[model samples]
Target: MLHLDASSSSNSKAISDTCNIDLNSIIKIETQLQDNPYDMISLVFLLYDVPDTALQRLIVYQRVMSDVSETNINLLQEWYCHASSRPNWQHELLEALMICQLNSIVKSLGFHIPTMRVFYLSSDPFGSKYINPVKKILYHACENIDSTNLKKLKKSLLSYDINVMEHTTCEIIFLELMSKKFITINISQENKTDEGIMYNVENIVNILDKLNGLKKIVNSLRYLQSKPNHDTIKLKQDNTNYGVDDFNDLFDLINQIMPNTLENDD
Candidate 1:
């Protein structure tokens, strides 16, 4: 149904050809599922892919879940397990597909689905380290201002698998949506104190400085880790020493900044 036409190079033709086959396979699989909702073999086969089948596979699963009654829960669970055991990209795609389908089902059925429970029970691992591909789907789904559901979804997102940049992007989108629908936080100017103001400013500056240092360390570590086959033992030892030094410096800085507080505590 969706055509991918990118005429950048010779490989474009090959990709298009593969996509055509993928489309046909998706159609056949959908028809089989519709005819026999219990067809686990066809469902499992859908998890397999060739080059350029990402979009095709996503479309097929979307169509399949558009009509929830056509899906077999047990078979879907098995398919999730199969997908999770594959590469990270495949796992991310499966997560996005599941979120899309669950949103559709919720809208159609006018009820909330326990997506978190389903994910946990299916043993589909999620965390902040993994990237989320369905952020837009999630953003739109929560636009209805169902506070209860939104709260639950927010908690679930803690384990919803997103990288640092994606997490920031999603938070911005969420804040924008909430701004449009709800009142912003209000603080009275009369309640401000000079001591409190100074403390808050110092805290903010300290946090920013620490974050800048941490970012540098993370970038350096990423570069070093990516270098092919270097002395791994030496690298590990160097990193361990680097981390210990950073922690010591951090603690010393904290002690210097809050010496009076530490004395009072003692």
Candidate 2:
């Protein structure tokens, strides 16, 4: 009878230990995510409440504008691969997840929500700190541009021997112009930076001035001698660092944007 009781007691302890072990075990997010790339990518994107435009701008700030994917899953995957190669990648992933309010994912990865605020990524990485006012204005004008005016603007580029394709958007056009040195930022003073950066807005302003609707957007800069505080411009910045792969992606975009021009050179 005592042997039977001892056996039952030992069996109970084993069951209790098993339960505690199950409760204490940590499940890694990567382990679950590794096999489900599509689902993982989609969840990140879906839960990533930040606007897609903001993400695109961040990509541009990182100089990986070419990786801009219209599709969310592709964009997330590209961003994930880029982030993974960087130092402190896990921290960054945690930061992003936290920003997205993805507590479950964070916990799954064995990270607790930081009690104190830790900014792995600033709320605005690509804001005024990096992009001067002139570039900021151009970015805003580009963002607000409509398809009709975009087509007109592209058609006008033909006169300058720059053929902007039919499918290209204003954002792409702006990037191409910036890449080719058609649009440039000239910083006048090391200090007093508010008035330091000068915009040679001539080429782009002139082109936009010719287009009926776009004229109102960029026309004010036409008369400003040095400091033009165009209230029409609003700025948002995305801060990310680009890797070699990202640079390659950007180069490909530049190539795509200026394919006709490149062929003409040959």
Candidate 3:
């Protein structure tokens, strides 16, 4: 359990923060997994976000091979190509490996898995499934939007059966979307913790882009980068669990993105 501490070196930061994998590393890793291409395919299967049926369709369409070993290897390579096309493929791959319990390979490759809190604070949304800064940033971006943008946002959600009210705040709209499962959070009810809720936020970013609010979000992130302390908010270390106030402060760090605009806006 390697946590991404604030003390990580600059060179390490370059590797840990990014989802990009070098060609040489990719080649070496693939070669190492030649002995168990089946495990490799399983890892690829986990890395894929789509349903298993989609993967089966891809396999049938691309490489319908009779030889099991060769087919598995080819499929692994194909999946690597597909996964690498995604912006956060490396992070996704690391997560997939963890899920597949490939600890030996993970250690051999020197993959560092950061805590969900660290991922939430990071600029990369794909680092963890945690819902925090990204969600809060989008929510703040929606605050005090003009009527035109509101109409645009409303129209976008019409397909999801979300009727945005003239006076509805961003919080209310997001809550509604979450309730309807249009916006999902990755949290387990059986093992609930203050670790933070996981969410897929790219859709929110796309919606904000349509409303012309993406620029504001970008600027807000730039502000956070300039003031890193604001982004690296320390959660209270009291109990094994956290209370409501601690959670509020944890997620509300995005409010510092643009105080005058997000906070004071009506």
> Best candidate, lDDT-wise?
3
Indicate whether candidate 1 or candidate 3 has the larger lDDT.
3
Residue 153, candidate 2: Cα error in Å is 0.6
| Residue 135 of model 2, lDDT score | 43
Could you tell me how far off, in angstroms, the CA of residue 251 lies in candidate 2 after the best superposition? 41
Candidate 1 per-residue C-alpha lDDT over 121-198 given as tens digits, one digit per residue, 9 for 90 to 100: 233222211222112222223333244543443444344332123222223323332233221212223433221111
Q: Write the per-residue lDDT of candidate 3 for residues 1-266, one digit (tens) a residue.
A: 12222223324333333323545556666767766644554543344333343335334523433455553344445556665543444544554555445556655554332222232334543222312243345444554467687777778887656675642345445545555556544444344444433445555556766666467775554443343222111121122222233323322432333333333321
Deviating ranges (above 4 Å) for candidate 2: 1-130, 186-198, 223-225, 228-266
What TM-score does each of the candidates earn? 0.19, 0.36, 0.33
What is the C-alpha local distance difference test score of each model?
A: 0.30, 0.42, 0.44
Of the candidates shown, which would achieve the greatest TM-score relative to the real structure?
Answer: 2
Residue 10 of model 1 has an lDDT of 26
For model 1, state the Cα shift of residue 80 in Å. Answer: 17
Candidate 2 TM-score, C-alpha based: 0.36
lDDT of 2 at 45: 32
Ranking by lDDT: 3, 2, 1
Writing each residue's lDDT as its tens digit, candidate 2 over 1-266 gives: 00101222234334222221111121344445444443343333322223243335434433432344532233444445544444333333444444434455554433223320122223442122112334444544655677787878888888888776743545445655655657654333343334543457689887877666555457545644355542212111112432223223323333344433433321
lDDT score of residue 6 within candidate 3 = 24
Cα deviation of 69 in candidate 3 (Å)? 8.8
